[model samples]
Target: METESVEYVKQTMEYSRKRAIRTKLVNFVINKIWKVPIFYSESRAEGISSVQSDTDFMFEADGIFTLSNEGQIGLKSDTSVVYVVMDTHEVHSGYTRIQIMEGDWNDLSEFASSGDGLRSLCKTFGNHNSKYLSNILVKQFWETRMKSVIPRQGLKNEISSHGPSTVIRYAADKDVVEVDTLICLRGEWPEVAKEWLERKRNFNWPTKELIEEIKAIGCNLVPIGHRLSHGKELELEWRISFSKAECLLIWSLNGTQTACIECMRLFFQVFISPKFPDLFSSYFIKTAMFWLIEETDSTFWQPLNILACLDRLLSKLITCVEEKCIQNFFIPKNNMLDAKAVESKELLDVLRIELTRHDVTGEEKWRMLIKEKLLQMDKNDIYYYHILINSLSVSRHFIYNSIRSSNIKDSKDMLMQGIQELKCCNDKDMFSDVCKQLQHELEAILSIVTFCESQSDSGTDRILSPNDTKWVEETLNKYTELSHSTGKLLLCTFYFYIERYQEALAITEDVQTRYTSQVVHYTFWNRSKTPRDDHYPQITPRPTLNETLKNYIALDVVLLPCLSRLFRATIQEKLYSRDALFIHPLFYAFFVRFHCFYRMQNAAECEAVLNKMQTFVAENMDVLKTTQDFNILHLGDSCHQLLKKHTESGNYFKKTIKSLLQKGEF
Candidate 1:
């Protein structure tokens, strides 16, 4: 019997823990490490294998928490976490592979097995699973679309590129009771991003209409790196999909097609897999089956021809290993066989000999066994087997009903309806729900506005009308209950955009604080001339004093951007005073009294602020490098230039400032 006591098991970087770990890690990095203050990337979560770090590295971490602009705790992370990130340094763009910070898996699993969790485990959510699974499939829909468009004139370049592969890690099966995560890429195959333009019917609301659309078009593509095509460099791309197309195609067959694929998988898993576990992977045969089916007509896949299909698929894999080439169906340039080519060839040769010896004199032992066991076999496919999905898919009844009742006609109609709904909704009881709906509608509007802006940047379209921007600002800021960190940032940005500088500054106050995180450092013994690894003595504050000061400097730098120039001197005075409201005791207290003086037409004070700015930069040169959160991409070079210019142009800067103010450039 399992005890009530929650025994904490050491976390590991295992396939079973990937999804949970990734969720936790993303929370940790976004809140603590990267401190992502502004831009967002839903297009992340897919990457090459190298981003992963040791499980121990993450487990040792005591996660840091972030405060919202209100100075309230924002998002926090459990120790067991993993993150998917881009290739940017500070590791900001990308995420570490597996970072396990904290969590009691024992109690959680037991809790999951009790009452509510147990009840949820029994519910059916097939439609919901398929609905959510569609985002990663968007690229797939485009593939067939592109095929037809390619033959049309002047369309090739317009649709030259494709994106995404299905991230199956976030998907689920029908029987799964736990809410399994499903992520599919050209790595998330069909993640259908919401558009700037709304959909006709269920436009603002979540609906089944959206689900069908995703099922039709979402997909992901692989990045095989760049190669020369003609005289120009062309990116070589492929796809890593437990393919919806193949599943749909196989389903389209008359009968027993699913059974045939199942049989082949069983053959590999039961026999071939044991012989060469690493090289003759279960996927090799299934991949071959998908390719063969794609090439053959529907007439070729029948109940009677199941055996033939299986045989042909196996032969195809054998040939692929022999030739060291398994071309992807869509992207012919991608060679799937390269990684295990040599090993697969050796295995296939050995298997052929083994088969010949065992099945002599008309004894088809392997074939007979596979066919007989087909019915009893579970639906074992790559997508289902490899993905870390929920046991139970969440119910979307509310969204379904909303879309059903609204019956929106098109994007424009949806937008109009949303506007009407917002105007009518005044009840405080429904505040949170209403705010969420409003935010979605606003996001839709913003996407279109941003789209037009991007087009303008590329000279293809004009900028959005001022009315469109005003509408977005109004909509985005209407939610008074919006306490989310991202939402607060958006609110601050909205105030900034509307030229409500005072409001923007007020909103920024909560972010102006001292923040610190614990990092472990170890001392090592110097053996010979090299070094012997060893643990450093544990100290209360830290093993080193430099790191602590660095935190103080970093916090100060973050607040500097939002600081009022007039009060720069006041802040500088309070730097060492206990009256400060900031977190870090040494928050940047540079005297900006000069700015206030200049604005007040007081020459003496004006000169002081500039001197203080220069002095402040010079004094903290050592800890300045820690300000990665501020996005001062090349702070070192830029700061150096500013310091040099300020020093050299000392007196002349006063005249320049006066000119700037006279010209209204201030």
Candidate 2:
């Protein structure tokens, strides 16, 4: 009996809840949907009524109609919410009507019964679900209850501040409910969102006209105007109801800006004239003068305009840098003492001063400054080239440090951009210098790559490999045809060292003309010792034949001895060609000659080779005695050692002597 009574109470509560929900929904449809205004007086006077439950009031183009089971309103669901079609007096009043919609009664009923719907909705909306679902009942009411109000033009006021909102109490004496005014505001206003809403609702002036007016000012809009205008100074202060700090900076940009332009022209004239006096042609100088002025005052740094300017400027600058003074644009470390280094130092000082003065430290400014200087540099000037390299190196280090410390990924492109500039260095010696630095850098980056690649589920390796390939291709491609071959070769060496062999091979093969025998040997020796055994062996069989080796007797001697050892003991000795033996004898003799030429002592190993060579020569002595220029071929200690070792071992120069005898018969 008690359980039955409890069940009855539960059923009663559920029924009441449903009835209350239906009532609220229906009221919203009638009031808000029907364009009704529910007014409440803050004062209890004039025979006004007090509130009970939420009520409905309607304003229609036609007269209100009482329901007679006749009027056609689009209410499809069994829920109490309904749609009424009518024209509302708002924007360009056409045949527009409100569409009534069913409320979430059925969904709510299912949610209450099963609890699954509530959980799903909670997951969907997260923390917002409680607020959204609970207030679902009031949403339709507010939507239908809205009224379109007329905008009022308010008084204009000037205030000094960086805040975005400026309020003016225009026509304060009048009973006006709406006002519109163009408030010169800053971008940093705390109530910016609120100001945006106010403007949208006619509480504040719209921005479209203001933007157009600023555009018509015949001066560009910027965070701070140029020297002819405000010059980063606070020029005026005005007060208003919103916030008092809304300051508008004003100046006669024409007069002042023109004067500043002339100043820039003079500055560019005298500053670089002494150094690059003949560097810029008359035509180019004139173009540069105009460009300098335009750059000084044009809205080049505006948020919307900056990227486009950078892109266009880069296109122009890249050609100029490639052809003219690319070196002036860079400052590699080795050339810091050059005159262009002095210029770069001065440029850095200027940038620092600008930053200090304006309290602005923007990466774009730094990048643009570097690029601009690069574009202006004379490409043929050695000093300028060094300076450009040095500058890029400095920037690379700065970006790398920043990226490392912050764990930011955005600096990836900046670092890469600096590296790209690095690759453009056409001077082999200078490029080599930069490549060494990059090789060291890759060690650190490689470790990071390894760590990232170790993640079990990460697909980063696939992404990183292609990215690395692209980076390498972009960095090394320009120098493939130029004088920077030595550096490029070394760069390839390190790349291969890091297991990026395919790219290394591609670059190295193209630049083979630059390879000295010493370089070939060094490259091959490093390859032999690489951790990647499979790759090293693949190249092992490749002959280290460089033209530079023709004159390098020492390498021939070393290589010949090593190759001869392979032939001496093998049953398949005939498989080794004469060219193989030709390389060995030449290699050993050259080394022995080197040691003797330099007056160095024969080491114990040399003493051994000397004995072997002597025995070989003694057996073949008759051959040499019969051959022309035998006296010119002065047999050294290596030959002496070969004969002595063989004689002491009791071979007695047998086979060699027979061959020498046969040669003598000829």
Candidate 3:
């Protein structure tokens, strides 16, 4: 018996060790494959770490890895960059319709004298009205300015070039990794964008400084290229980009706003996109966020209002999704969503389904997305896997369905079976598999509940009664001990919408009690809290195995509404001050607290935040001390200057809060 027990323990140890190694390998491969530069990572736009692709070791033939300013991944000795996506600092979501500018300009004075300049040239090259320009001035631009020796490619390589835009395709990581480089200029900017340019006050985009210092002399060009759309007349259109200015705009976002934007993007990507297909691009979401910020004050963008802001954005998106409209930030005439509606009305239909609440005015979708339910009881596999498969089939069909005609009731019955299987399954391994597969069914269940209760969509709303809410709350809480963080996250979201803010905050804690639940969302938001916003929901986009880790689920933004109840007393007392450690988000929290102070017109607390921020950066931060660049110290000096500017201007929350405070209601 002793020997048998010892053997069992040895087997368990070996299994555990192998599992850890497998997990580590998956993490390493995924990060190394996709990670770009720390400052401007596309991985954040997509994913930080992923488990989507297989780690193919079949090609052990050519091994290499390397890194560069762009965070290139290849062999250490092999830093062969075939192309660079020139001026990547300017890259953003909305700038689409790539147009390649061509031809020569030996004489600028001829066109510089004309009032239209590049615009006149664009009309001459195209049939003179709608088309912009082609065969105009690209060769002269690249040839004269480039000092570096031009490369001559040797055999078996390809260059697909048009005007200035060239795609230099190259491979890394034993040629398993492929990348394309683009060369283009900022073009096609409208008058509204110029008006926006005049509004800039802070340390603008690095490109903005470049433009001001060198090109204030007013050199200009018309970039002409064909649109990416297929089967068109191929008219040359003048296109431009404002990516540089936009990057600076992104930098101005404080921690709260950034987090909120990311969360909203995640929501659009996860719930909205799957149902709507290619209709909701990241650009549409980002442009809406930017427009919303322009309409609000800094206090309105604070952590406490993150969800409220997202709610407003979503309400607006419902209009865009339904009416097939989303206006471009720089060009209001460019409705970004119009082109997305050509394929079918399925996306519009799917959105309506999800957004449809008894009280919510926006969404109304088809009941079921599957045309026919498959069942073959003679097969043992079908009998075992049918419930799981059918639930996801219905869930995904609505997402992938473009036909717009799938409203059969295949899932309603499968859902019942799934619940039954959960209750009956006793085999731990089989039960885990069912839970993993049935998570979709769970999400479908919760999205409906969330939609009904959130009251997020504007239109006279209906609230779930206490009994109904409690029932749903009890149902959500069932997974609290089941190692499913998503279920817990859903439960916390339920608590947040239902106004149980204390319980919502306690969901992240190891031990829970009424007294310990004092950690309100903004309490942690404005304080120098240890653990930060870690857990992003798993049900977002697609579920990968790695998201099961506890730290990956975030709940703070949803709970931020609790701040409205707590901020007045804290700002009034002029208490609670702290300095940030390196990367602890200490400075960010204090920045928020100071803004709260400013909003309340509490001058003393605002000054306290600035003094502490300055001193902390000067003294404690190792990175700042080593670099001696005060800007790197949590962007310290810039933030100080902003606060100082605000103080000097005496424009303290002039929008909503100040007006209310002056009226004695706040």
lDDT of candidate 2 over 497-572, digit per residue (tens):
3455456545544443333332221110011011222222233333222211222211111111111211122201
Local distance difference test scores for all models: 0.31, 0.28, 0.35
Each candidate's TM vs. the true structure? 0.27, 0.17, 0.32
Please provide, for model 3 over 1-666, each residue's C-alpha lDDT reduced to its tens digit, 9 standing for 90 to 100: 233223322332332233223232222222221111111112221121111111111110011111112232222233222211111122222322222123442223222333444334332322332323332343333233221211111112333444443322221111212122222332223332344445553433323564353223211122433333432222333234443344344544554445444555555554566666655566566677777666666666554444455567767766676787777765555666555566556766677557544115422211110000011112222222222322222222212111111121332333344444444432332324434434443444444334343433433245556765665666556554332243454455455545565565455333222112122111111221122222122234443322221222211111111112222232212212211111222333444445445555677766766666655454433332222122223233334444565542133222222453355431
Top model by lDDT, which number? 3
Superposition error at 523 for model 3 (Å): 41
Quality of model 3 by C-alpha lDDT:
0.35
Q: Pick the TM-score winner.
A: 3
CA-only RMSD, every prediction? 24.7, 35.6, 29.0
Instruction: State model 2's lDDT.
Output: 0.28
Q: Mind giving the per-residue lDDT tens digits that candidate 1 earns over 1-666?
A: 011000101011122233333333332322232222111112012100111111111111111111111112124244332211111112111110111122222223211323432122221223332111121222333344333211111111222222232111111111101111111222122112222113343222223543354345433222222222211112212223323333333333333344454455656556566776666544455456656655566676654455556566666665675576766543344566554544356665676665444334232543464435432223222112111111000101111112211111332343445444444433332233333334353454344344334444566434446765665566555532232222334455444434455565454444333221221111110000111122122335432222321221121111211122112333334322312112111222212222223334565544444554444444533322222111111222232233434443253334444453465422
CA lDDT of 451 in candidate 1? 35
What TM-score should be assigned to candidate 1? 0.27
